[model samples]
Target: MPSAPSERPLFLDPNLNIIFSVTLLAVLGVSSIAPVFPTVARELGVSPEAVGLLITVFTMPGILLTPFFGILADRFGRKKVLVPALLLFSLAGSSCSLARDFEVLLLLRFLQGVGAASLGSLNATLIGDLFTGRRRTEAMGYNASVLSIGTAVYPSLGGALAALGWYVPFALPIVGLAVAFAVLFRLDSVEVEPGNGLGRYLRDALAGMKNRKVIGLYLVSVMTFIVLYGAYTTFIPLHLSERFGSTAFAIGLIMSVGSLSTAITASGLRYLARHTTSERLITYAFALYGVSFAAIPMLPGHWLVALPVALFGVAQGMNYPVVMSLLAGLAPTEHRAIFMSANGMVLRVGQTLGPLIMAAVFAWGGMARVFHVAAGICIAMFLSLPLLIGRK
Candidate 1:
C-alpha cells in the first residue's frame, strides 16, 4: 500500500502546489501559441495546410526523444532532468520570438516540444513519486484542472500578444519557463534505484507496452490529443476567421471563452477526485468530450460557439489528470520516467496524425466537416472506455 500524506515528512514532500503551478505555466506557454497558428502562417507566408505542420513540428521531437528522457529520469533523478529541461524550454521559446523563416521556426518549435515532453512526463512521475492513494488521486485531479486553466488562458493571451506581432506569442513561453525554472530549483531531488543501464530500460519499457491497461490509457491519451488538438490547432482559427472575420485579437477572445469554461470546471474536478475512481471518471469524460465536439458543428456562429468549446474544455480538464494519475499508478516506481516518456511517444503519434488527417478532411470537405470527423474519432475512443475502466 502507498503511504498517506500525513505520514510523509513535509520537507521531502513533493510540494504539489509548486509542481502544479509550474505545470500550469508550462501548458500555458504552449497553448498560448495554438490560437495564433493561422496568423503566424500568414505572417510567414505559408499556407494553412503548411502551417498545420506546426503541430507536427512541435510534436515529433518529443515523440522521438521522450523515451530516452524518461529512462534518464528514472535512472538519474527527476529534478536533474526537469530543471535543465525547463531551462532549455525557456531558451527555445525565446528563440521562437526571433525566428526569421519558417524553417527556423519549425526547428525551434520541435526543440520546444522536446522540452515540453520532458516537463510533462517528469511532472506526472514527480506526482507519482510524491503522493499515493487518495492523495494521489486528488493531486491528479488538480493537475487536470490546472491543465484546463492553462488551456483556457493561454490562447487568448497568445492571441492578445499576436496582435502586437507574430513573435509575441512565442515570447509567452519565456515568462512561463522562467517561473517553472524558479519552482523547479526549490524542489528536492528524489532518489532512483540503480538499474542495468540501457538494456534494462528497454526491457522495462517493452514490459510497459505489453500491459493492456497501460496501453489502453496511452491510446486514450493519443486520441485525446489528436482529436482535441487536431481540431483546436486546425479548425478553431479557421472557424473564427470564417464566421466572424476575426482578427487575431477577436480569435483570442473566442478561444478565451472556451478556456474560461475549463478554468471554472477545473476547480470542481477535485470533488470528483474524492467521489470517483480515475478509471470511471476517464470513461465518462471521454464520452462527454465526444458529445461536446459533436455539438460544435451544430452551433451556427462565433457567439454561440463558445458553448461547445467550453463544454469540451470541461471534459478535457476532467480527463487528463485522471489519465495521468492512472498512468503513474500503472508504471513501476523504478521506471516512472521511461513509462511516462513512452506514454508521451504514443501521444505524439496521435498529435502527428491528427493534423494530417484534419488537413485532408479540410481539403476534402472544408472546415465544418473536420469537427464531424473529430466527433467520430472521439466516439470510437469513448466506446473503448469500458475496456479501460474495468481493468484491475
Candidate 2:
C-alpha cells in the first residue's frame, strides 16, 4: 500500500507527486521547442532540417547513454542518479537560450538528451519498485497520463513563448529546474542490491530480452515512436501551416488535441486492461495508428486534421503504459533498471529514426507518402504481431 500522508499532500507519502510532476516537467526539454523549429530556422539563418536536429541531437544520445545511466541507477541508487541528472537537464535546457550558433545549440541539446535519459529509465525503475500487480498498472497509467498532459501542454507553451521570440521558449527550462529542486528534497533513494560486473550485466540483459515476448515489446517500442515522433517532431507543423496558414499557436493547439486524447485514454487504461490483454491492446493500438496516419493527409481542414491525430493519441495512450508495465513483469527485479534502460535506448533510436526516415519519405513523395509509408509499417507490424510476440 502507498503510505498514508499525515500533513503534506497525500501523494507525497509515496513520492507519487514528485514522480508525476517531475516526469511531466522532465520532458519539456523535448516537447517545448518542437513547434518552434520553423521560427528558430528563420532566426538562426539555418534550414528547417538543421533546426530539426535540435530534436534529434537531444534524443540521439539517449540511445547510447541510457544503458550507462541505467547501470548507474542500479549501482548508485535511483535518486542518486536522478538528482544530478535533473540538474544537468535544467542547466543544459536553460542554456539553449544563450546559444547564438546552431552547432553550439546542438551540443547543448545532446547534453540535455543525456540528462533526459535518466528521468525515463529510472522513473520506470522507480515505478517498478513502488507498485506491483494492479497497483503497478494503475501507477503506469498515471505515469502515462502525466506524460500525455506534458505532451499536450509543452508545445502550446513553447509555441506561445516562441511567438514572442525564438529565444523565449528556452526560458521554459528554468521551470524544470524548480521541479528538480522539489525532487531533490522529496524523493527517497531506493536501496538496490550490489550489481554484478558489466559482463554479467550484459549477460543478464541478453537473457531477459531473449524471451520472444520481451523482444516483441522492444520492437513495438521502436516502431510506435517512429510513426509518432516522425509526425510530431517534423512534418505535422509544416503540413498544418501549408494547409491552414497556422501560426505556432494553431500548430501547438492542433498537436495538443492528440495528446489530450492520449491523456484521457491513459487515465482510463486500468479499466481497459480489465477487459483485454496487453498484447491485444498493443495490436489494436498499432492498427489505430496505421489507420490514423493514413487518414491524416486526407484531412480536409484544420479541425478534421485533429480527428486522425486524436486517434494516434489513443493508440499511444493505450500502448505505451501497457508495454512498460508488461516489460516490468518480464524483467527480474535485480536487473530491472538496465532492462528498462535498454527499452529507453530503443525508444530514442526510434524517435531519432522517425524524423530522419520521414524526412526522406517527405522528400520523395511529400507528406501524404510519409503517412502512407508509416501506415504500411504499422500495418505490417500489426499483421506480424502474433509471430513477433510468439509464445510467452
User: Candidate 1: where is the Cα deviation over 4 Å?
Assistant: 1-14, 180-184, 273-277, 388-392
TM-scores for all candidates: the values are 0.90, 0.94
- Checking candidate 2 for backbone clashes, the offending pairs are none
Error of 1 at 277 (Å): 4.3
Summing lDDT over every window of 10 consecutive residues in candidate 1, give the lowest-scoring window. Answer: 3-12
lDDT for 42 in candidate 1 is 76
Quote the positional error of residue 62 for candidate 2 in Å: 0.9
lDDT of each: 0.75, 0.81
lDDT of 2 by residue, 31-74 (tens): 78878877777778986455667778888988888888888777
RMSD of 1: 3.0
Q: Looking at model 2, how many pairs of residues clash? A: 0
lDDT per residue (tens digit) for residues 13-73 in model 1: 4577667766775575457877777777778899887887878887777777888788788
Error of 1 at 114 (Å): 2.5
List the candidate 2 regions with Cα displacement exceeding 4 Å. Answer: 1-14, 195-198, 390-392
Candidate 2 positional error at 31, Å:
1.4
